[model samples]
Target: MNTNTGDDKSFLNRLSSIVEANLSDEHFGVTELADKLRMNRSSVHRKLKSITNKSVSEFIREIRLQKAKGLLEEGSDNVSEVAYNVGFGSPSYFSKCFHDYFGYPPGEAKNHTKTESDPIELTEEGKTTKTFKQPSRMILVVIAITVLLGAYLVYQKLSGNPSEKSVIVLPFKNLSSEESTQYFADGITEDILTQLAKISDLQVVSRTSSEQFRETALSSPEIAGKMNVNFILEGSIRRQNDNVRISVQFIDARHDRHLWSENYDRQLADIFAIQSDIAKNVAKQLQTILSPEEIKQIEKLHPKNAEAYDKYLMGQYLCLKRDSISIRKGIEYFNQALEIDSTYTLAYSGLADGYYALSFTGYIDRKIGYARAYEMAEKALDMDSTLAEAYAVLGIVSKFGYWKWEEARKYFEKAIEVDPNCMVAHLYYCSFLDIVGEPDKAFEQVNRAIELEPYYHMTFRMKGIILCDEKRYEESNEALKRSYELNKESYYNYSRIFLNYLALNDEAAALEKLRELFALRPEYLEYKNDITPLYESSGINSVLKMFLDARLELGNEDDHFLIPILATKLGMQNEALTYLEKACAEKTRDIPRMIRKPELEVLYSNPRFVALVDTMNLSPYFQKLSE
Candidate 1:
């Protein structure tokens, strides 16, 4: 016998009211109840607490438990049917809950609801037994069925999730030692990422970031910290011969607890179905709010040509690398895929990515390739503008080609809007904000990108740069170190670490670091500029002249303004005159804005340079630095 305190009774009554109002609709939850009751979210949450003294999740579970118990008692269907009918994504999860809630597995609780919704038709084997006193030929239904069903229905009525935005999909595990099969496992995971990315409400972390943890031994909370997710949808895939076995679990990362987990073993031909099922179940478990458009997008299928689809996935895998060499390889593979199936929108998207990469990597003149890249992206968009990659690359072309800052922002934002989980959009958007001088926003976006892919060196390295710009040099150094430790291959990352050290005025340490950076890239201008501060305070301009010499040899007129400023600061007016003439000849952009530059400190008192500065409309930028 279960007895309730006063608080529990009040909760039961409120739940009963909710059930009466919304017993038919399956989607009702805390958010919905709060809305119907016309109360604030926290207020409704408080009332639910006062009534039942149960957390919303517990109430939901109890409701689900009751439904499962009722169906078993009802005996209208077998165990699988009951599980599905009662909205349990898996019979195994339902049974585990049933066992926990009722002290018996669902199999034992079956056949009890058959005689009536009230009477427990306890089954001896499969059918309900005649009665408590008589062992009839009919099987018996379980007794606890009615109570459980009623409780679950009531729970469903009171709970809701109203926000149709945001999601976090956990990384898929690979259960194979063969590296070849790694691609398939990764393919399945990326496939899920891509599918979920189609949802405008969902955020999907990039597979590069997700895959970094394939070997992580971190706990759920640690993983969540690394991924920066509200919830995690983790799964495992094992491909043996032609069949695949997959198991997925959803965890509330903040709680470090599992919400749901299930395994699926299906034939190769049913792979598409498997992918669809995974996405739907994840959304259901998280109680994700999706618009009708998002729901439809979530259900879209892979290409019909299976072989071509495989090739296209390979192209996607390569293109996702986002480097010069890999982008070309991706282009080759995408072409191979499209040759097999011309209508593959994904392949078109991949090709668009390749051209976009070429433009940015300087493999082609951006001026010439901008329209082509835009055209290719438009084609993919025409076929499917919802593709996150296409949107990201298209956004970049808008930025660099037309200087359409707002339009570029809209596209980048939409790419994230399409999939909040996209690391690319998160990353590039951070840099874009940096360009607009929003260091605070840039700081936030880059940190988010780092959180999404902590183990990925590039993302971490980028976070270090943004952090440095935010004057968080200590934090920036840590990020760069982590990045270097992970990917020991990039010399450029070390150059950055050295720069951060210089910024922090670790001069003794910086001197050695400067040597290291010069060893990595002797041509790096940063090395020459590293010693500028030594003379900047002393008003000596010769301190960093190697940089100016290098710029002069490069024949860039912009160096003219820099040289004259340096010469005047060192009290060398003749040298200043030489460079100022060069600057006036070219009318360099920096020359027009000389007051905005510190390099011109040497020229402040020179009459000729002062007149030149006035002529160049640079007076406004000339205020001397305060001590």
Candidate 2:
């Protein structure tokens, strides 16, 4: 009755063959392998565990790591190249895994090639047996001692600087039969994530990254490995009438162990209390000490009206969809929430976000959209001064709408100070830094934001835009490609890609991207295909005249600074200076950015341009170039 003999051997043979065939595909994990084997995931898992004494994920990882080690020993490629070749999405993650598994980093693997051995090969009996070259007794003793010392040092280092506490709250499942309640479960998951992020003592993965695993077949360890998180929280929500039920479990993802589990059945009004309780319990279980202010922040509740809160959550759920139609619908839901509770600060903040989205996406008149955003943001802050989102909204409005640089900077700084994990604040501040002639500082802030929300399309798009401005075309295209992969329908990502191609002087690629941009939003067809044709046909002077004519006809106030850049690109030094003076008089936020723009180099030699730079107090930022 030993089932591990015949078919088991065949299964192991097939699995080994598949793994070897796809050894370089980093994404060839348990799910893909299961699909390839034509077996259900659970069945594949059980069979693999029984045969290999390891979970499916662990088996696949070991295969990849072993392949990577072999590649390194061969010395054909550098460590990073080997990492990517072995299907690792990130080289650093690959290096860490390699070091943990092989007792040495890949960088040092080449130097110690004499000690390396071939990886274990699978036999027909479905068992692993290593073959090693025989060595002298003294050599064996020396190797054993070296291994013991390395293990001791690793233990000491791990104990001293314990890894930072991190968690990913997976999207809560809707256990209710009614699919309409899915939004409620999603909102609850996001609220819990937001509460944890406010602690400043934990690295909470952003909703975008966690949402990717909503329907994934990957095991807990696999998800945790990909996200680089130690803990995972998953839950389900069941709602019946006025009573709601939530069951949550906190898991130590690294060890695949459940650390805590709780269930709550409460009236709808007590949902806020339930959320707060869950967050506090998680923090306590993780042994994270929260400051008094952090505790108070977490304990703070929104409006008392359950209906209003539900409406607000619905609004937030729609807002996160990030489309023009969804944004408008979100606005309606926010307004509904406000109608139910006129004094709801979060509702006001949501409304402000909706308006800001409208303005930023060009779905509405910028002036009207931004003015409403400003008003709503002010109201939110007046009601709750500690609201980080409200401050972020105000900062964005000030930066893009009013061009109030100092005020925008202050608001952005205050938002981060209030909530250190606020990704929006970090993103806006990064863009602000870029516009203010501090590309190095801007790069740092964008990277921090990316660390917080790695899968967020807008964050990557902004990174691409910033890199494009810095004239790092190759890096900019890589980021933009990632952003496009996250959400291919986004015109924002496509536009940046277009700009990057243009900067790199790849006219065909730029045109292709421009067409994609136009395809996504046909309203831009005229601007992309028709009005801007003069620049390609004649020169910047012809394009400048056409721009002037269009401005006179359209009367758009934004992007006025582009006129000077066009003039400068045409080699019209006086015209560029004149346009720059006009832009300065208008308090254009883009003025500072011109310092690094190659198009504006002609104007830089002018004393007026230098004076304008000095007047903006941008000399200090430029001075950093030398330092």
Candidate 3:
């Protein structure tokens, strides 16, 4: 019989309902469940813990396991099929968890009988909460010993022995009196992550993914479960003038065991040493043997001067803001860092990144931005031949700036070879694959980027864009919605969502998203008067025509490639081909990306379009990569 109060029972029922609803979605976790419950994650976690004494993940997994058990008993599916049906991504993992939870393996569940208590608990006390009513003393003793031993073995299996080394380093707390020191703390965390990521055997979650927990109330174990990692690294930083204090702790989040921790109090100049020590210690604790190259990469320090490094960190912090002004300001800081030490490879790379951002976002002239970016990247590479970022920047220049498609591929591959965990390389390569008409390879590359930084908004945005290009409108919108939820202020997500709506012929939804996007980006608001009435009268094509007009009126030489895309959507085949010919003749930066859109699929058999694509020499490389 159930022992819970009415409120507790109802709450548990509602929680179960939510979990069961999303049982097949492996990405559905504590946060998504909390959102469905219309409560903060902390509130849901605390209330559920008080009732069940199990973490949210344990609760969700229990529901999945219960459904899997029922399915198995019904003899409806094989173990692998049932595992996927019940939200487990790996059949072996499901079997292990099933055995741990139910005391019998999934295979034996077909003939096994359940004798546990009504109020199921995940803890050891759950094993004996309710026993046989009138068992003999000798039998009771034997059962008790067996249960204790079984519990011990399960505990040892789950907590004592570890698996493949994977970890998420949460954002470090900034304890400095000055709030501005937060950037320094973040830079420290990022550098440590970089060092750890250099080790091929260690899987380190990127800073963008781990940064989501900066103000979270969840426990380390909960975070670990959400990130699908077994360990967590957390720290606090306090900086004052020339002195800094950093306290770092490494934990086996699964067992809640503190594997190692240390406090470092040193001058600002010793930060490099501190970062290296932390990475080395983490690797040591994990019993990972670092290759010589990984050791060298971790130990390499830059700008020897503390002040120069400080400016570089500031540049990185600002550039992450991703706005035109902040990016330009970041460039200034990078330049300042280089003035202090002209040989600082990272500062040059930072400059290249800033210019790349400016060019990519159309904040600067394409030629000027790419030229400066290329120069800075080359300089950085000359100083540090092993710099993965330099190679990635060169790849960007080769692809979008020069249209040297094969050269771009080599650069991106080399970047990944230099640093297997280079998210930039993976991301840019994803776009390259898509441009070459290899959507499957593009999907794989983008998914790899998502794995490295699951919480990043851009990765999902890219996925949405790819899906939309494939005419998978509903799936595209789902990915775009996730991207929007991650960063509501990002107009890019709004734009992509509306584009998907347009593709789906949902003009009303498209208009709504357009309005939201224009609200975020007021510059686009100037065209509202010209568009809204036409949109109501003639629908999405009219809106696209007005946007095309606006783009033409802007007289931006770099954006001429957009003319063909809009023209193609309106079924103006001759106009699209003519403008595309001009765009190709003028060597527009975006022409390659625009030509591959599904809207232009009508031109696949057109002689002019075929000739244009042939001139670009894309098909051979597409076949090469697809092979």
Index of the highest-TM-score prediction: 3
The Cα error of candidate 1 at residue 59, in Å, is 69
Instruction: For residues 205-278, write the lDDT of model 2, one tens digit per residue.
Output: 89888988999899889999999988788888776776667777777788898866656677755555654554
- Which candidate leads in lDDT? 3
The lowest-lDDT stretch of 10 consecutive residues in candidate 3 is 135-144
Model 3: residues >4 Å from true position, as ranges? 1-164, 267-289, 505-564, 571-589, 603-627
TM-score of 1: 0.51
Error of 3 at 316 (Å): 1.8
Answer with 1 or 2, whichever has the higher lDDT: 2
Models 1 onward score TM values of 0.51, 0.59, 0.64
**Candidate 3 per-residue C-alpha lDDT over 290-372 given as tens digits, one digit per residue, 9 for 90 to 100:** 45565566546434666677778878877887756556656777777777788888999998898888776666666777888
TM-score of 2: 0.59
Lowest summed lDDT across 10 adjacent residues in model 1 is found at: 134-143
Better of 1 and 3 by lDDT: 3
Worst 10 residues of 2 by lDDT: 135-144
